[model samples]
Target: MITDDTTVNGVRIGGAEAGSDQGARTIELPSGARAEVRKGYGRDLMRAQRATAGGDANAVVFALIAEVTRVDGRKIVYEDVLEMDLADVMALQAEVIDENFDRPPQRASQASSNQDSQSRS
Candidate 1:
């Protein structure tokens, strides 16, 4: 089942031309690096959770990103992400959030309010 268009270096490619992999997406970083990110499995999430236990929110984000992202065909570890530029980290953060977090629907109050600029007491 190895096709020239799909296999590279004995590994199968998994995006766009390959028909897309479920729970996986590619992210282009601000630093000009391309990363393949996949939804974290339960074990991946647990690993991040354990590593970030008692740490700040940012620590959790960093750990999760490290656990799920592969940049330029290389697996980046937590320390690698820690050393990345702030902008790149933020870009990855946005992608990770987009992939893993579900956005709630717009609130009715926000959708309906403030149309006339009249302040109600």
Candidate 2:
């Protein structure tokens, strides 16, 4: 998601969801540094993604949460964008941008899977 990190003129900020979630996420910042957030959320999902396929999933979990709250005192509402593929999230995120920005946001590519957008975070 191209997160509404487009802070409201100065109040800096920040899905995240608490259930079955997955895929690549883009958290737009005031700065141009590209942020891609990985790792799944939700108990059922955390176990399902099998983030390790076989390794230290706790570490992965820790890092993801760290990034979510790192920007000291930032208050954010989690916006969930469902689907496994990052590309899909990018496209949907673009649409979300369009809704927010008014003009059409760029879509990365065609979806590999046909599904409706789901917002959870």
Candidate No. with top TM-score: 1
The estimated TM-scores of all candidates read 0.65, 0.19
Which runs of model 2 end up more than 4 angstroms from their true locations?
1-22, 42-64, 67-121
Q: Report the lDDT tens digits of candidate 2 across residue range 1-121.
A: 4444444444333323321134435555334334444333343234333533555554333333333321223422222222124553444344333332335666655552233332321
What does candidate 1's lDDT look like per residue over 15-112, in tens digits?
Answer: 33232256678878889999888776655676687898886778888998998888898878889999999999988998887656567886768635
**Candidate 2, backbone clash total:** 7
* Residue runs of model 1 more than 4 Å from their true location after superposition: 1-20, 110-121
In terms of lDDT, model 1 sits at 0.75
Full-model lDDT for every candidate = 0.75, 0.36
**lDDT over C-alpha atoms for residue 54 of model 2:** 51
Query: Cα-based RMSD of the predictions, in order?
Result: 7.7, 18.6
